[model samples]
Target: NVEATKTVVDLISEQMEKGFEIPSDKVITVESSGSSDNVAIINCCFGHRVNETMGRVVALLLSARKGRNIGIEIDPYRIKLTPASSKEVLEVIKSLRPEAVPELAERALLDTKLLQWKIIHSARKFGYLSKDLDLSRINLRKLVIKLKDTPIYREAVREIFVEKMDVEKASELISQFGKSIKIKVYDSLSPIGLASREHAFDLLMPGKPVEALLRIFRQRLEKEVTVFHCLNCKYTVKTPIRLIGDLRCPRCHSGLIACFNARRKLEEIPKKELHRIANLVLSHGKKAVLAMNTHGVGAENAARILSKYYENDDKFYLELMEAERRYIRTRGFWD
Candidate 1:
């Protein structure tokens, strides 16, 4: 197992050294004399670290050259290229400035979710951050900025490097590229590479389609509870939109009801404002209830949306969808 690990690591190192290029449409595979299952395990374990290390190295270098962030997937046995060709990647590798690695590595970690989680977890362990802190309430980028030069941040980076990556070995192999190691491309994956493919992890890229976003928005609306306040009697009731049917207030028998998110406290709101909301609901009817029930849309915004004329229900819904999308995109900033 030890030898297999070293062999897989070395194979990955060679591939990274060559800038991860194979013949067009051809796959590179590792050959082994050992049991295929053992080879697979070795590839999964060590190959991942090697590929990840090299992937970071290349990604950082490319990002520097291009003046923008570049993303890449580090498969168990390969470093998937972003917008760069094999030749360009090889040039970047060849021109690697060893002195810049520490800074580059740190920069590479900035956008990684793993590093962020590790930083938070380590901070909690060291009592720098509260153990029960609500992760959703904090801005991760700001947190990282605050902890950048602190011991907690350094410890997190160290743990990631020591426990999960073979950056030093990868660097050494890259340094020895021409002298002791060389690239060998293959037409297809070998038996061991095929075995490695059996347990490969899935890569999930970001961004959702408009339809998917709308579907999610619809689901959220269905589950959302709205507080209905009767202006006449000051009686309030909370009901989920999915279960809400009757529009009339049971206590006052009035259709003049103000709608708010269930989280809103009636006591905190001034009576005059509550009356205004009630008037809004009375004027717009069910449309005002729906607008208020929409995530992140307050009474004023709902009023603006309800006041606008739409050609049809579809156009009105599309406007609501845009409002929801805007709210989603900016909610973190709001927090």
Candidate 2:
């Protein structure tokens, strides 16, 4: 029996050796899972991103091992004990048991730290979390805008801000809030420190030299949606979180901090204000930062933005799972 398992493991190892990029450091071994007779597990599990890849690997093992392709009849061939999936993951979520996230992490066969962060971060995006889940130390500076009056166009701008970009929603927003709203971006351009004061350009003030403003905006916000100042050096840069390690200041390598949230900056604003912002950008001969609709005023590559931030480091996935469990017990399932 042990030899049969070993043979299966060897065939898998051989297949992995051929073309797979599975790490050499990973120990391919069999162990008792307590619930099953024998199990072959990847001790260094990569998580949910590897779902399809694992499916392919298993399919290859079944087809190539034991001399010929063997078909095992079953309702569904489940992959268990992988970071991305397992028997417990499917059963736990599918049954709507309201299991705490850590429990879910165990069921999913993922490291608790990495899993907790991923789930919490994802949940927070849509305002689902009961409290702020700010485990990540990524920082940025941002400008916040609030609509003057609740215009009919408020819905449209809100939709754009969130990057949902629904045509019908936009149209509905246009009809409801379209031309009636007025928007005002804040007036914090007065630089507090000497450096900002020296180059202190008033971006919020309407009808300033459009060309200079356009150049300044371009310089500050390119790959980054917005710009923020460094806490220590006061150097301005907007960097992605994944590349946070590379975000050291050119001068002092000090920390960067954001005053406001770049994404979803304006929670609720009037439609006319959204229109004004678009027109203001167009008048300046600059592309509207939030592009959408026929004129492309609020359009965005929504998936690209989400993909950048939703990345997870598997080793530290659910670092807060225990905290989450305790929180849930104190309050209720929604927590």
Question: Candidate 1 lDDT (Cα, whole model)?
Answer: 0.62
User: Can you tell me which runs of candidate 2 are displaced by over 4 Å?
Assistant: 1-106, 109-111, 129-229, 233-335
lDDT tens per residue, model 1, 61-144: 877886765545454455544455444555666776645565666667786766887788778778887754556567878888
Query: Against the true structure, what is each candidate's TM-score?
Result: 0.44, 0.19
Global lDDT of each candidate? 0.62, 0.29
Clashes of each: 0, 29
Q: Pick the candidate with the highest TM-score.
A: 1
